[model samples]
Each structure stands twice: as structure tokens, then as C-alpha cells.
Target: MSEQTDTAAVPTPEAEPTSTPAPAPEATEAADVATEVAEVAGAPEAPEAPEAVTEAEAVTEAVTGAVTEPNVWAAPPAPPKDRRGLFAALRWTAAVAVFAAVGTGVAYGITQPERTDIPGLSTKDDGRWTFPVLSRPALPAGAPVPQGPDNKDGTHYAPLTGLLLPAPEGAKADDAVKADKDGVVSADAFLEEYTPEAREKLKQSLEWDGLRQIAGRGWTTADGTRTHVYLLRFHSSGFVDAFKGCDTNARFTGVSALDLDDVWSKAKNTQMNSTTLDFPGAANFDGTDLSVYQEVKPFLGEEQTKIGCLRTGDVLGMVIQTRKGEVAPVTFHQSVILQSQLLS
Candidate 1:
């Protein structure tokens, strides 16, 4: 039996275990490629949740309500008034008022007539010559009728005393009896008393065509000052203008006699200086021609001498005043003022 068993064991080869037939090389490589593909193509991820807000941010949003944009369609706010602009408007108003006032005054001045009476030398319009404080001299009782039939030419051959201005306070008529009679004289006769040069000059000056007559008076003051007044009448207003032209052109200063040798020298001394004379009134008095002159003569001790001539309508008037050692109580302007009043 032992022998038979040994023989059997030797004869039965040990059965090889069947290891999953050593996998094929190609199949193993295919499985490895499938695993790599799966790793490259990862699975799709899930969506993330939103972040939470803080408590402070939530409280601020609740307190200030939601902000909104301004409305572009609404009207804008009105602009503030400018204080400087208001002041400028007020200034413009005041300037307009001033201009209006000035315009009114200018219009008034242009429309109004020129005044006749001056302030200081006011005259009365009571058909006679009168002043504010001084009364006019009364006509001598039953004085000879003016320009009587005997003087048919109306040449003023009769006495002109009634027409002459009254004497100053301290002065009296030079010739009380013959003053009125001697006042009237012919131009030719009057020129005869002057030097030849003076006579010739006066002759040419007095050649005012249509001259009717001339009357004049002379007075000597206590201080050796001399005053002369003359009145001239012309036939027509044209003649008066011509006479004034000649009188204004003639120089009557500095020359001892009416000589034209040094006309330029004499002209320099005849300029009209400032005085109280109402020249504007005199010039406008019913269309008058007026002029004033200065005369200086050392021989007569006269430093201040003045003469004024005026022509109004058909009448001309002249006044001459001379001052010697002292200032004359009456001024040439006063004489002219009174004389002009009488003439007016």
C-alpha cells in the first residue's frame, strides 16, 4: 500500500493556481487612460450664497430715508437782490430830478423879459423921476412952459432945468439965476470954447445928422472937483445910433486936448473898469448904447476922473466927474444912474 501511494503522489503533478490570466497589457493601458480622463474633467461646482450686510449699514439706511435725484423739470430758485444795484437806481433818480430842475430854470430864463430896474438904483414909474430915499426936486412954481411957441422947432431952446437931475446933498446950483438959461447951447458954440484940436475932434464927433439940440450944465465942487452933465436930442432913432457909434469910437482920456496924434496912447487910458454901475440895465434900457471912460490929468491934481455916455431912443446923455485932492462925495456912477432915471 505504501508503495502504491508513493507512486500515485509522484504521478499527480501539483495543480497551478489560475492567477486571472495575467491581465493583457492593452487592457491594463486602456484602464489607466480612462482614470486620467476622469481626473482632468472635474465635477461641476454648486453656486455660492450672497454676503450678509452689517448692522450699522442697516441702521444708517433706515434713519436717512432713501436719497433721490433733484427734479430737473422744476423752476430754479430766485436770485438775491443786489444792494449796490438798489443804490445805483436811487442815484439815477436823484440825477434825473436835478436835470429836470435845471431844465425848468433855463426855460424860465429864456422866456422872461429883461428886467428894467436895477436893485440899488430903483426908480419910480409914477410919470416922474423919483428914488427910494431921495425925493425929486419940485418944479419951480409956474416955470416957463417947456418948448413954447417961441421955440417952434422943439429944439429945446428953453431951459432944461426941469429935466436935469437934482444936485447932490452938499452941492448947490452953480448959477442959480442963469443956470436954467445957460444950459442950452448950440454944438458949434460949445466947441468954440475948446482948443482948435478939441474943437475939430468934437466937430467931427457931433456931426450926428439929424441932431436936434444940446443942453448941458457945469458944477464946481467945494473940493475943486468939476462935474458936467449934457443932454442931446436927435431927430430920429437912426441918428441916435450913429451918434453913439461915433461917441464910442472917439477916445477921451489922458490927452490934454482932444488930439488924435497919440490915439493908441489915449485908447489905453479909456478902458472901462469895474464899478457899481448897472451896465447891463443901461445897455438893455429900451435899446440903449452905453460906454464909460477914465481920464487922468496931473495938472488938475485929478487922479480919478470918469465919464459915461449913453444914447437911448433919440436922446443921448453924458456925465463927467473929476476928483482932485480928495475923493468926490458923488460918484460918476451915481450921476449917471440919476440922469438915466430922468431920461427913462
Candidate 2:
């Protein structure tokens, strides 16, 4: 029994601990390994990103103004629409000139055909001042030219050369004037040469049948140069005169001494401007200064005739249009000498 007690006291050889609980350290180590493996398996990979949006934004900012705005352009305002005045007319005229310079006809196509002919004809080809040149009479050296015009005896020659000579008092040239066979010659025969047909035609055209009948008488003349002179009667007086209207376009206007202005006050109020005739009287359309009155004002006495006329308007006037300057001079002695005895 004692032996059995001692054996019982001594540890008995038992089977292994089949149902023993595991230690806490081993359980904690297993949990740590499982946590590590779970973390490794469930971690997310690096993500694939969006590509061109940033570069596109930079390019958009570079091209257009704003990155967040629309790209359409705002248009500019147009010119105001209003009625035109002088400046506008000038502008339009300049534009038309430009178009014409470019070989266009849109501007001047609106006016009348008569206006196409410039008044003074600055252009040489324009036919405003034109006429048929009368042919000179052909004579075989000295063929004994006759004394009278057509041998009619109605006309009388008022001798002007006689006025220069010493004459008897009260024995005037006008008193000696007669229709048949007057001994003195006519002054007009020296200025112009004329054909019988042209003389007759001009007489008829100017309606001077009385002067024609009178001039038809044979009168002795000095110079032989032929010209065509037309008789002109003054409206203010019954005084008759003649001029060479050879250039049909050149015209002459005569104002009477009754229409003279004493002072320049009221006269300056009227602008004597003609497109063909210049104010203050320039000779040519281009600009050649003409005026016997202006140049010789000091020579003409204050009481002398100061008749001023302009070529611009309805009043007809005279222009010689001959190649020669001073075709008709005021006087051979003094340029501005007002012939009180003649023009008056």
C-alpha cells in the first residue's frame, strides 16, 4: 500500500495532453502573420491616370484669351449712316476721280452731254472754240485789185486818218461823208480780209443789211489783209461798231457808258464770274493774265471810262481766240486810254 502510495506520489507516466489549450504567445504570433499576409494581399496598386487634360488646358490658354471662356471674336462697329454735305460730296468726287484714274466712267455718266464740253476748253481737243479758217484770195502778183467792195454806192467811209491830220475848223469828216464816190478810204478795210460770200453771210447772220448796203460801195483801202468783221449795235445807244467774229465761239459784249459805275462799292457786290470768262479778265482758261485796264490804270485818267465786265454768265461777250496776243488792243497809243470819242 505504502509502495503504491509512493508510486502514486511520484508522477505517473500519463498519455500526451491531447485536449490542452494553446499558449497565448503562439496564438498572438499566428494572428500577427495572418495580419501581415492580409495586408500584402489586399493593398491597392498604383492607379492609371488621365493624360491630355493639363496640356490641352495650357494650349487653350495660349491660343484663346481665357481658359474658361468661349473663343468667338467680337466684331467692330460700322460707320454711321447719315446724309452727306459738301465734304461728303468732295470725298465722293475724289473717289470718282480715283475710279476714273483707274479707267472707270461711273462718276461722270450722270451729267448732261452739254456739260461734257468744258466752257473754256482746257483740253485742246474739245471743240468749243472752233471755226472754218477763210482761205486767202489768190492774186497773180499785181492784178490791179479794184477799189470798191462790189461797186455799190450806198455806203460812206468815215475817214479816221483824217482826224490825225490838220483839218479846217467846222469842216468835219462826218460832214463830208457821202454815199457816192467819197474820196477818203475806210479804216476797217485794214484789219480783216473777207470773201464776198463770207461778208454777205456774216452780214445776214448778224442782221446788218443796212451796214452791208452801205459798205458795198467801192472805197479805197490801205492794207490788203482779209478778215471777217460783223457789225454790232450797242443796246444803250444807236452807235454801230464792227469786230472779227472769226472764231464763232469767241463773243463780245458791250455795255454802254450809261451803265458805268462811279464807285467800286456796288460793283464788287456782283461777282462777274463766268466759267468760260474769268473774273478780272484772264485771257486763257489755263491762267494768262490779261487786262489793259489793270496794267495801264495810272495812264487812264480818273475821269476815264472804267467799264468792268465778267465772262461767266448769261451776258454774251467777246474773245478773239487767235494765236496772236493783243489781237484787239484798247488803243495803239495807250493801252487803257478810254476813247471818250469812240466807245462813249
Candidate 3:
């Protein structure tokens, strides 16, 4: 057998080399699925999930170093404010307020009155008056007689002067008769012109109690007779009627003969003889007439005095004439008639 094997080896071909073959497709597929499963289930435990980072850790890391994680979550930044738009809104509001204030001021100015220019009279800053203006009253219409010449140039008395009795033909406006428009003589001052007893009686009379205004004038006749006239305005006609009672008896007239007697009885620095007479043309009028003699130095002759009083409506007039001789009753009657006509 040995001789036979040698002989066969000498003639046999070299045996072929053996090699490993590729795995089957099913086995490779199974092995790949097992590896994927193992990676999913274990996967090195995913490094313990990095211990879930919080907002504080994120902020701390950001402050300490530059952030590296691209997927890190955070809140978005706030949008920029519009400063120009805010300023524009504030400017419009201010403009509207200023316009409203100006409009209100203009409306108020339009309602005020215009300023006036006058001496001694001034307008206030608000266009009101500081003092009232004074003017003369107009004359009443349809007078019974012509009035006296008006003294328009006279201070404060021009209006009243037109109602006074005219001076003698050659007489002039007397400065002594001039007074303030609102008379200077008060009730007490006027009473001083009468005797004590007459003053006392007048103070108790109705006319004196209601007296309102008094104006007086002095005149000299062409023949040198001195005359003084007094005008008294009472508060009402009833006061005038009470003063010169509504009676035909001259003595009953409250301001008639009895008043004349009292006045002469209390005269000082004079010895007087008096006569009370019924005034002619005055029977229907409220009037009285009186004649008196005043004694001067023994060598000098007695001074004659005549007086008359009359009332028309609420006005009472008195006329007194004095000279060296007895005065006529007609003289006082004429004077009273003229005054009454002016009053009417």
C-alpha cells in the first residue's frame, strides 16, 4: 500500500486552496436588525440625558462663557418703542390746549364795552365805569310864562339860573348869589336867618320838616331898594298846603300874619312897628303880606321893610324889600306873581 500511494502522489494534481465564502443575505439582515435593537435599547444610556439644563443654568453659562448649544430655548427680545410717535402725540395735545385757551380769551374780550375818554371819569380794566356821569335835567314843557335869562357860564348853577327871577333892568348877575348846584344852605343854616321865636315855630311846621332844597338871590332895584328872594322846594304839595293852611282867613294861614308877628317880635338891634295886610290878587293864592318899620340911630330915619311869601305846588317863595320909606304892597305882590308863574 505504501508502494502504491507513492506512485499516486507522484502523479496527483496539487490540492486547491480553501477560502471563506460571503455570508447569506438572510443572516446579514438578521445581524443588522440585532445591532439596531441593541443601539436603541442601550446606546450607552445616552450619557444620562445631560441632567436637563434649566433657565438659571443657561443664564449662568451664558454669563460665564459663550453658549455652544444651537438648540437651546429662550424668550424672544422686546420690540423697540416708537419715540417719535409718542412725542408727536404730546405736541398735538399741547397745541389743542393752547388754542382752546386763546379762543376763550378772545370771546371774553369781544363782550366788553369800548373804553371812553372823559376828564374826572375813567373806565376800569374790565371796561366798566369808575364814577357816574352827571348831566343837567331838561326843562319841563309848556311853561306858563317866560323864564329868566339863563346863566350858562355860571358854575353848577346854570340850569337853575334859567328858572330864577330876572334882575332889575340895569342889575347884573351877583357873585354873592352863586352857589353849588346842590345848594349850600342846610335846614339849620337857613333857620339862623330868622328870629329865635320864628325859627322855633318854623322848626315845628310841616313845610320846614319836609324841606328839600333852598336857593336864594339878592337884588337892588333902580331906586336903591334892596330885595332878597328865597326859593324853597318842599318834599310834596301836601307839605306846602299844610304850611299855608287852606283857609280864607289870612291869620289862619300857618305862615301868614302870626308868623310875621313872631318874626318882628324877636328882631334884634331894631325897634319895629309892623302891620299885617291882606295881599291883593292873593286871596285865592297861598301868600301873605307884611309891612314893618325898623328904627335906626335916633338921628337917622326909620328903615322900611316889606315881606311877602307864596307857595305854588311844592315850591315856596319869599321876597323881602327894605328901604328908607314905606314899601308898597303891590311891589311884593308883583314879585310873588312872577315867581309863581315860573313855578307853574
- lDDT of the candidates, in the order given: 0.51, 0.28, 0.47
TM-score per candidate, chains pooled: 0.41, 0.18, 0.37
Question: Among these predicted structures, which one has the highest TM-score?
Answer: 1
What's the C-alpha lDDT at position 27 in model 1? 38
Query: Model 2, 1-344: lDDT tens per residue?
Result: 34444444566697886654443343344444444444444754322222223444546675776655321121222323343464588799999988777664534543444443646433432212222231223434433221234413211132222111121222222321222343332324412333333454554544442222222111111221111111222221111223233232222222112222322223224442323222122222221111222112232222222222211111112211111122122221111111111111
Question: At residue 36, what lDDT does model 2 achieve?
Answer: 48
TM-score for candidate 3, residues paired by index: 0.37
Runs in model 3 deviating more than 4 A are 1-162, 172-184, 204-208, 244-301, 328-331
Judged by whole-model lDDT over C-alpha atoms, candidate 2 comes out at 0.28
Q: If candidate 2 were superposed on the true structure by all CA atoms, what would the RMSD be?
A: 29.7
lDDT score of residue 185 within candidate 3: 44
Worst 10 residues of 2 by lDDT: 335-344
lDDT of 1 by residue, 205-253 (tens): 5674676777777665555556777777777556766663224345434
Worst 10 residues of 3 by lDDT: 127-136
Q: Taking the candidates one at a time, how many backbone clashes does each contain?
A: 0, 12, 0
